[model samples]
Target: MIDISRTLNADTPTWPEDEPFSYDLTASIADTGSVNIGQFTTSCHTATHIDAPFHFNNSGLTVDQLPIDLYVGRVLVVDVTTKQRITPEDLALIDLQGVRRVILKTDTWPNGAPFPTEIPELDARLGSFFHEHGVELVGVDLPSVDPLDSKTLDTHHAFEANDIHILEGVTLDGVEAGLYHLSALPLKLEGADGSPVRAILQEI
Candidate 1:
């Protein structure tokens, strides 16, 4: 199995406009001179993460409420990177016949962008298509599946309306576009909206 998700570290990339992700050891082995202990601070949505419905819906499900099975499944990798933004037009290019799990590779990654911007927003119509088709989850390389500039975020509402889980802030830059068993599990944080994950791709 190849671990595709980036490591959860202090240097992990964050949303361009949002605050940078950070972590620090409040108590370390060097400081205590006994055991290696430390405390950290960071946004749950940092690095490779799973977005709970609660991220969008005020009363939707939390990360703890997510089914474990949803994290592992036969996923379809849809390579639709022709457009700057992923819309219905771009998704229509793929053959989603019986695909259950879908991961859109927009080449979204953690790289040399001094300040991040919402350049890639998905189309509102495509959200309905995925939900109507019963897609268990959606993973993408961008900070979000929805457009970065979306205030109302019709795209997010569309997916959250159906309890769709999303895995965002991925770094699938070198992965080949194809089907694979995905095991990108989120942390078991109780009552949390999201959790950083060690998103991995296991070849079946």
Candidate 2:
């Protein structure tokens, strides 16, 4: 399996002014006379993660309520590295029939070096496009499906309205565009807006 998840550490970039990832040794072996105990604190949206519909809609399903099967299945990776604003017309050439998961390889934020100030706009029209193609999960190599400064989160809501779930912050730099088996399950955090996921792709 090829790991697509980003490394989560103190340096991992998060949304501006959001809580940064932190890990601390709560108990040392010398003090506890046993193995060291560690603890961490992070934003639900940090690193590679899945956004529950609740992240944008107060009435939508939370992380735990999402179907697990959606995250583990055959996925098609499409390269759209050149476009700044991705629309259905932009992806008109790719064949999406029978594809349940689609991971767009937008080499925009290839290294996850830092939180991006801006990213390619994912047209709200994709909601209907993906729905027409039977796509249930959409993954991206950036922080969000919508514009960074967008407060309306129109694309996010559009995905939810169409029964689509989102997987964000994936690292698809060296991965080629093709078919792969994806396993990017989010944490079963009840009543939570989102959760980080250890996303991976297995050669099919």
For residues 97-163, what per-residue lDDT tens digits would candidate 1 score against the true structure? 6777888887644443332565567777777888767786888877777766667878778777765
In model 2, which regions exceed 4 Å deviation?
none
- Using TM-score, give the best candidate's number: 2
Q: Mark the 10 consecutive residues where model 2 has the least summed lDDT.
A: 109-118
CA-only RMSD, every prediction: 2.3, 0.8
Worst 10 residues of 1 by lDDT: 108-117
| lDDT score at residue 54, model 1, on the 0-100 scale | 82
Model 2 lDDT tens row, 16-76: 8678999999999998997999999999999899999988988999999999999999999
How far does residue 180 in candidate 1 sit from its true spot (Å)? 0.6
How many angstroms is residue 155 displaced in model 1 relative to the true structure, after the best TM-score fit?
1.2
